[model samples]
Target: MKSSIKRYLIGRPLKSNELGEQKLNKTKALAILSSDALSSVAYGPEQILLVLVTIGAAAFWYSIPIAVGVLVLLLALILSYRQIIYAYPQGGGAYVVSKENLGVNYGLVAGGSLLVDYILTVAVSVSAGTDAITSAFPSLHSHNILIAVLFVLFITTLNLRGVTESASILAYPVYLFVIALFIMIGAGMYKIFTGQVTEALHSPIGTPVAGISLFLLLRAFASGSSALTGVEAISNAIPNFKDPAPKNAAKTLAAMGTLLAILFSGIVLLAYYYGISPNEQETVVSQIAESVFGRNAVYYFIQFTTALILVLAANTGYSAFPLLAVNLAKDKFIPRMFTIRGDRLGYSNGIITLGFASILLIIMFKGHTESLIPLYAVGVFIPFTLSQTGMILKWLREKPAGWRVKLAINATGAAISFIVSLMFFLTKFTQVWPVLVFLPLTILLFHRIKRHYEAVGDQLRIASCEAATPIEGNVMIVPVAGITHVVENSINYAKSLNADQIIAVYVAFDREEEKKFAEKWAKWQPDVRLVTLHSQYRSIIQPLTKFVDIVEHKSKEMNYRVTVVIPQFIPKEGWHNILHNQSSFLIRAFLLYRRDVIVTTVPYHLKK
Candidate 1:
């Protein structure tokens, strides 16, 4: 039943020739890779504050330090991953790097981590976008889950059409968000500098609590690290870039890095300057919009634009998940389903699977952006650690001319990323570990799947025991049912076997019908004789088994081996099996118990 449903959802397995229909270009690839990175500006600041607020109002200032740290980490990661893209242009990304440098276990860890991160990217981006929309329309506040699910469905449909299409559609909205954010930041800065600043607009109504602790700082850092989530996508997607893949990928990485740092830093600064509370209660972007543009046309317009960009940002997952699955498929870590392209030439199955998982997450968390935050940094940090580790290994192996400099850079990057990853894990374990539990389980599942495929491959290998060879004095028995295509095909198959003697057997369930069939057969081919076996119980298997036993006994006496050619009808529909029952299967099963008998099926394709 599940197999039937899968067939209905994805259709039959496709041949290799069908894969070429969908191909992605550099611009589209860049758009996809950069969307999630750029879109973080809308919520990364908010997430930081959401965490810091737990430590009291003064902890809100920690956003500045955390943002700076995140910026440094982001730049370091970008530089390190640039080396990765140059070294490996394949689409394996972190998994490929870790597998090559670290080990298979490390690679599995990286792959599993990246898989979870990509899933969270979709969920967080959509939920954040939903929050933006709900802020615009308070009525939607309670129905965020429904909105998120519908948005996931909508994104899934667009992705099903193909990556190039979804990327192209998303490019404009993401670019618009970038432009709008820059304008808002510029205007806010102007207001601050001109001494024309109005009362701190959108300021929290009550005085915020004031205190700080090491745990709060760690939480804030983890929250800020959300901006770093999509940075590795460019490295993983080097192959999707245009010709001169390495250079194009490097440039895309640089652009993503610069854009994310500027946008995220700008939002954090503006929010801080305006006395916007890093309280979990308010989104930084919402406060900024209300402050800068007032609760009027411009404020609402910015809200609408931000919401659109945030939602469209999920296009990153729509693009990355399919490509990641394809890489896994190539490595045999995932089923061949991931390698298949849909009618539109996209990885439709992968995209739909990603969408479903995202929707489930959004629903499970009730589209609450804050609750999903704990699970957010864990997955991203895993890939960051491994990717940086991969770079360090690459530097070690190649030992470039500036060996000392490159090694130092890679070593430092790896150490920092590793530390931050550990911090994120420790800080988020209580709130995030539940979602992260899927990581190791996924790795084990992939390993098992790989083992299963290997076992099947071993079974399919040709064995010397079954090698085709000439049979000595082979006797053939053809199961006949009157003068029909089934009988004709079975006889032809027996002749092809090069048997010493061929006997046609007709089983008599109804004596009169059997007699009529024998008479007709005799009239058509007088040279060939018909042997009839009577079944008083009207059971085909019992009569066939008795007849085959007699034939084998006779063949043994003649010093020959017997082969049976059974004529079988191909069922046009699944229901056709119920109409005809399992007579052929029973006969084949019975014949298999005999040592010297070889049972072969001669299929007769029946017209619908």
Candidate 2:
């Protein structure tokens, strides 16, 4: 049954040779990687408008400037990360670059920040996707959290199927979304050219009251920067591409960047011309769609596809998070379990961890996109700054062909990103404090893990082992209940160990049972002697623990080590466990924690 579920959901386990089969081509890679950036155009503009409209209609015009600023930053990141793809073709984004150039501490910061960003990406994308749905149906408002959770589960299962499979499943929605945006832009542009436009069907509340303050303007810029969240994914995932991985990844990155810039600029421009405003229900894009195509099918098509692409955009995090965790694991900065590939060649533990984190976020925030958005970009900009900073340092140190030009571009990008990160940190400090706390703790965890691995390597060094205590004879102890086949089998096992001595002990709280067992043992005349301990109170583990303690103490005085071989019953049928005493488990648990004592489990299968 378990195998069937595994096979059905993730397919058969693949061999290392079959890994090449999982490599994604350019189109599918673009779909899987670019959806986050593309889908942001849905709420990205809305977020900008949301911040601007707080001041009033007069400030609403500032959305274009904030968006263009985000666009400039976006272009800079694209240029900066293209360099990263080629340099770190092995595919370590900010973390690898920073470690190589800036040092281990900087790498930890990049890695921790990237990880937090990936989790937030899933949370923010799922919430926004659900918001899109609730905006369309409105009736599903109460169940939006459930909807968000189910959608994340759906994407997680798809990804667990394998990267190529996930890309194939998710590719079309992103393409459709891109095509839809282009068409929407063309239609909106034609209407503008033909003078076939009107004011927004509804504008924001009242006219401009308080003139825009510098802080408010900068706040709006920070809010608009959410659009740039997923741009770094391609740089991190270059290894997932086919042969000529770096080149293919760079091409895909370029394609995604060009598409995002066009779509975002066009959408924001149309929103401005149509005079769209932030709304409590529906989105700015949804509102713009209504004004562009009225309440017709085209408008509905836009909304539906917006929701489809938005929900699926969480796939970006699903793809990137597992890989990021795997990278950290390879560095010994996280558990090795995250590095293990599943049947589908996905990082199974990492995928499950990301999914659970996303589900918790949705539950905690009640699927409110606005609340999650505030915590979004701080994670993104940290890596952007680090990656670009590392790239500048890379070009300076390597001084490759055309190095000066590369250096200047990366230096500009690094500066811009540093400023953006600082702005987000300052402006969103109250709401983003948890993220600030999480990053430092994660970095500390990385350091701790590194130290642990280093310490383990010290203890497990082969040279150290050879110079250590030499093993001699081992004393083996077996615990038995009565003179039965299970006890007979355990005694035979102990004799096979060739120990200096073998002892079988039984604890009896009742006097008659002890006498009966001793009589049976005498009659059988088993070569191994049985020592019976009478417990004044009804206790098995305490008496057994004392016996092992005595054995251990004697072994310490000499060179011999002790082994407690416990006989465990394996019930053939699941329900049979209730019929058997679990004394073996109790005895083993007590003995297992003692130092230098070897504990082994011997399973005696019960046929009935």
**Candidate maximizing TM-score:** 2
TM-score of 2: 0.94
Give lDDT: candidate 2, residue 231.
93
Question: How many clashes in each candidate?
Answer: 1, 0
The residue pairs in collision within model 1 are 57-209
Residues 1-608, candidate 1: write the lDDT tens digits: 76676555444555557544344565566667788888878877877877766665555566777888888777788878877787788767888888888988788888887787788888988998898888778876888888988888888877776555677777777777778888888888898788656544433433354566677776677777777778888877665566777888888788778888888998988877786774444467888978887888777777877888777778877777788888888888999999887766777788889998998889888888777755776677777788677777777787878767766666767776777677767776677766457777888899999999988877677863455434458878877656887778788777776678888888888889888888888887676667888889887777777888888888777667888888888877777888886767778888888987989888888889
The global C-alpha lDDT for each of the candidates, from Candidate 1 onward, is 0.77, 0.85
The deviation in Å at residue 276 for candidate 1 is 1.6
Provide the lowest-lDDT 10-residue window in model 1: 199-208
For residue 212, what is the lDDT in candidate 1? 65
State TM-scores per candidate. 0.76, 0.94
After TM-score superposition, the amount by which residue 540's alpha carbon in candidate 1 deviates from its true location, in angstroms, is: 14
